[model samples]
Target chain A: MTARPFHRSQAEMLPERAAPVTTAGVVGWLRANLFSSWANTAFTLIALYLLWLIVPAIADWAYFNADTAGDDRFACKSSGACWAWVDQRIGQFLYGFYAPDQTWRVDLAVVLLIPALAPLLFEGVPFARQLRWFSLAYPVVATFLLVGGIGLEGIPTDKFGGFMLNLTVGLAGIVLSLPIGILLALGRRSRLPIIRILCVGFIEIVRGVPLITLLFVSNIILPIFLPPDVTVDSLIRVIVMVTAFASAYMAEVIRGGLQAIPRGQYEAAQALGLRYWQSMVLIILPQALKISIPGIVNTFIGLFKDTTLVIIIGLFDILGIGNAMVSNPDWLGLATEAYVFIAFFFFIACFSMSRYSIHLEKRLDTERRD
Target chain B: MARNASARRPGSPGWQRLWSDERTRGLIYQLLVILGVALFVAFIVSNTIANLQRAGLASGFGFLFDQAFFDINQRLIDYTSTSTFGRALVVGLLNTVLVSAMGIVAATAIGFVAGVLRLSPNFLLSRLVGAYVEITRNVPVLLQIIFWWVVLSGLPKVRDSLALGDAVFLNNRGVRLPAPLFESGFEWVLAAALAGVVATVFVARWSRRRQNESGERFPVFWSGLALIVGLPALVYWIAGSPVAWDIPKPTRFNFRGGFNVTPELVALWIALSTYTGAFISEIVRAGILSVSKGQTEAAGALGLRPGQTMWLVVIPQAMRVIIPPLTSQYLNLTKNSSLAIAIGYQDLVSIGGTILNQSGQALEVVGIWMVVYLSLSLLTSMFMNWYNRRIALVER
Candidate 1:
């Protein structure tokens, strides 16, 4: 067969021209996105009206007319928000009935967390490989920092309340649950009948009941169960309950990740003559855990939010403190301001964690990325 | 070289071979685990017995039959302060079920609307829905409930109560809606409604078969709707309309005549629905996204309408992803009903807490809570599992 002639390439190109006003500019964007059709135009108007109605009022209430200088109950008498009340009582809500002297311990606990956790979370951080070990010691250090025993004066668990207690329980729960979750996940997958059943039973039962019921059990029934001589701190008991609950959810998530791993990866470990634990630690867990990081963080978000449920158990978590602040004799009828502040606090925590988790998920997307 | 086939093996294997043999190792590990767990359990049991003995607290569920001696403000069942603890618990459980069931319906409706809007072709609608979801999702649900409570309580007094055509009344006390008071022939009307539902199913099946075999179109949805509505109304008319309206009236102190729904229930219901809806929208969005774009294109190429493409192709695949997580959301809503305790809503846990304090049967009360909650969880999951199986893909 005869060959076809080759096409020649142009050395240069004509200057680029702007697109027509109907299709390329701001007007075009509005046309294409907001007012493309009758339905779209109607929707745009409805959305705009809703925004117009709500946005200014909320902004006005939150900032402009908000009373920021006074501390009296009627600071909000003019129908605006009472930021003044929040300003006066911020410390009380943040720390609850915590000892004023030992408040620095709470600050130190928070400050120490960022540095201890940074290396493990981000790339190119100093001592990244070695910092994971610090997570183990961080909780111990924090416990002493809050309760104050070994080298410092005792503050007691009763003093641990508000956002301080929430952080303590939330952080400790996440850290403690991870390793326990891994073992339970493995046990559920094991061929051994008893271990599998035990792991399954624990996960199912823990997940079935609400955390409030568990908190009640921990606050009341746990003491009845334990020996009279051994006295566990209330905060410690709450932490254990919270940790056990989180571990069940974590196990389910990690199991999903494990199920996603290829059979060949496991069989290869078996081929290499590695023991079950060694193979899981080296081959299976590393892969499984990497995939599960996002899910684990999601569980952390839920767990942290659920910590506010401790309010029902009479623990002054952030929600509890907020509730307490509103009902204060001095700041009565400031439920709006109190709730708004606590809502923002929780929102910031949950939103940031979720965003970071999404970012990490994108970065760790080895298999899915094209 | 290996152990002789004819030789009898030792009953108890040594540690050296236990490592070499997988089955032996598994068995040994399981045995050790059982022993450890048993010993720890025994220790806890002994400790609990000793502690209970010293504390003078007996741990048995015998108090269930004893009088509750507590009045629940909002109850479905006939419960008095002198009612049995079991009856009080039943009232609590009934309240839990009512709220959770209603919340599920409301949340699902809100969720589906938001989910659909989130993927709207109109950018403004999508963005608005997205913002709504993000704001609702980020904040703690408890705070939302509290906020709603504050807002609802801020409503005007009973004399100045908001009225909707004199059929409903809203005030600080609660919302009062006109309730249907049925007379004698209501049972016949109900029977007619049941027949309508049965006939609609048969009609749907017949329409599907007719369309498949003869390529003829049928107004199945319209007919089904008409039948369901018309049949009950027809029967009611024939029986001289055996239902009377008990309209809510704004009395001096409170609304009277119609059923009153407490503000706590309203606040809890709205908050839970909105909060869970945000989550459900995300789940639905993900489910829809999981079905590839190629699916729609293929359906379009087959000459199916967009609606048909959705119902026949995309939704079927999306449902596989949606159902499992939807079940979890349902379970979450059910569990969250316990949050009613915060606002002094008489849920099981709250009532149980009262029983525990009054009777000093903390252990037994806690056990009751566990059993009831666990049973609920099992039932919900079992039902979901069955439904999931029914709708699951048949690869073969």
Candidate 2:
């Protein structure tokens, strides 16, 4: 036999002895992750110290010592937090000044939103193609339910407030801005120079300025520009301005998607004797929109958050309702509680949307890879 | 004969040919758009004129020169209620610039630290940082501003100020800090600092050249730090340390005379920094992740330390990914500063609102706001683009 250059473990495989304590299991993980070096040890200790300092205090204030129920400040005897104010005004926070009896309409509309969004946000749902028709008509039905149309009792726009108003403005803007945004995106890339310039100019100007300024324009300047006898509803005006602002941003996002389409794809469509719009609708836009779903969702989240800006112009969204509640004599000095409550609502809405977008991105990425 | 009849001829009628022609269709479409736009503009102009006349509101910008009767709580420049509306607006703009600049600096610092720490080997630290990013980002910034405002305003009363080592004070009113009273010869110390910066730059260049030539590595960081600190110190000592402290002292009701940071500024500054910092941190994390793991392994194989690998191999590549989004975040922070109005921080939009109400020149005031913001956005984007181009990778 040839002499072995290296020794080999040939004694019954050494009975498969376990790894040493220092290099195995929990101790090994700790050594590798948290105390691999002096700096890492220090970082871990500092993090622990910081958590020790902050977490308990926050937990105590927000939960352990907190007053969770009551009607007013007197009910909150604890020094931690006065959540009683939030508890008392939860209705106003949810439905604003809407008549309590009519809140069922708002509730129904909100419930319908799930089905309306399901077909768009997910794949493989039952009868998704048929459900899209409901999605298309859902916006109108929801509006009618909330606003009181042909068959329902009349509810003026002024009466709209609270979280309901936020959903209204955000959903309406999302639905309305898309078509306009698509057109603007096409316009910006059109063969006609004037259309491109006009589209570019509108987008830049709107994006450069804050939403507050546009709201101000709608509040004060829009009236001056309209005909003397033609008075538009304030909520409608807000919706119009919001749509304009959102469409500008949306157009940019869609344009990014449009630009990403390979020249070969356009050529392929053209070679098949398709008209411009037909090619866009049948081939390009479907792929482009799928690619831009994450961006569109992000824009929607931004628009949803921006609905709070209407408070600055004197319309009471959820934040406005919270602010107004805080200023009430019975709830004075409860701004923290009010803001926290409103922030929690917004956080839930925005965070879930972001999470969904990330999930969709991953799914789309896998699909593309496949 | 049928095919010939169906086929378009060169002698076809002009109207029919023009109708069918793509180029002519485009031209006609553009002309219609122009005409429609002109008519719309004319209608708006006519209605606006009629409305202005009807309301008896003057439309000129002359109101800018009129006295602003309202008191601005946080003016960076010299201003009183008697100051012109223009001066008040200038004060507002300066305040906005101050908050935005400070917020940007603080946000960047926090963002970089949190981002790196979040990717640390220590699981607790990373999770903590992740939580911070998610919670802060998901919350609306307006609510944060108001929350901070309320928290700051709910601090101990002026009489029971929270003192910090006898130099800083905090109360419901705001933070009070000792102001530096600069005397003569401080300019010499400033000059020394400037000279030290120049010298450090030169030394860095020299060291780089030396390294390239002879494979020598200089202690550039320590030497640069020494130069910057030592020169300033020497000058300060020679100039007799011409700076005195003006520490705030508690009086009957409020702190007496040092420097006062109003609650509005404090609240707005803190909220903007924290909120924007969360976003910036995510951008930084993404950028760092975009730099492949192969880079770190390669640096290790080349015998570079972990720190050196991060600084030299990873960060340079990461910066390219970080910068563009970072620029947008900066812009977002600047624009979000307009929300300062919500908490009475008296930024440009707030001041403009007051001016609009007082002067009734809504159009001009809004016009000024649009122009100013547009220019600010343009200038920031231009500067950031230049910086981005300078650091971009040179492809082979």
Query: Which candidate has the highest DockQ of all?
Result: 2
The superposed Cα distance between candidate 2 and the true structure at residue A112, in angstroms, equals 0.8
lDDT of 2 at A351: 95
| Candidate 1 displacement at residue B92 in angstroms | 0.7
Q: What TM-score against the true chain A does chain A of each candidate get?
A: 0.92, 0.93
DockQ of candidate 1 (2 decimals): 0.72
DockQ metric, candidate 2: 0.76
Give one digit per residue, the lDDT tens place, for model 2 in B1-396.
987666567678769878877999999999999999999999999999999999998888788899999998787788999999999999988988889899999999999998988888788889999999888888878889988999999999999999999889999999998999999999999999999999999999999999999999898899899889999999999999999989999999877779999898999999999999998998999999999999999999999998899988899999999999899889889988999999999899999999989888989989989998898889989999999999999999
Estimate, for each residue in A1-370, the C-alpha lDDT of model 2 and write its tens digit. Answer: 9986665755445577899988899999899888999989998999899999998998898898899788788888987888876656878889988888999999999999989889988998998998899999998899899989797888998899999998889888988898999999999999999999999999999989888889999998888899889988888888888889989888989999999999999999999999889999999999888888877887888888888888988999999998888889888988877887788888899999999989998998899899
Candidate 1's C-alpha runs over 4 A off are A1-15, A127-136, A366-370, B5-14, B55-58, B211-217
| Per-candidate TM-score against the hidden true structure | 0.94, 0.94
The iRMS of the candidates, in order, is: 1.2, 1.1
lDDT of prediction 1: 0.86
Point out the worst 10-residue segment of candidate 2 chain A by lDDT. Answer: A5-14
- The lowest-lDDT stretch of 10 consecutive residues in candidate 1 chain A is A71-80
- Kindly report the TM-score of the first chain in candidate 1: 0.92
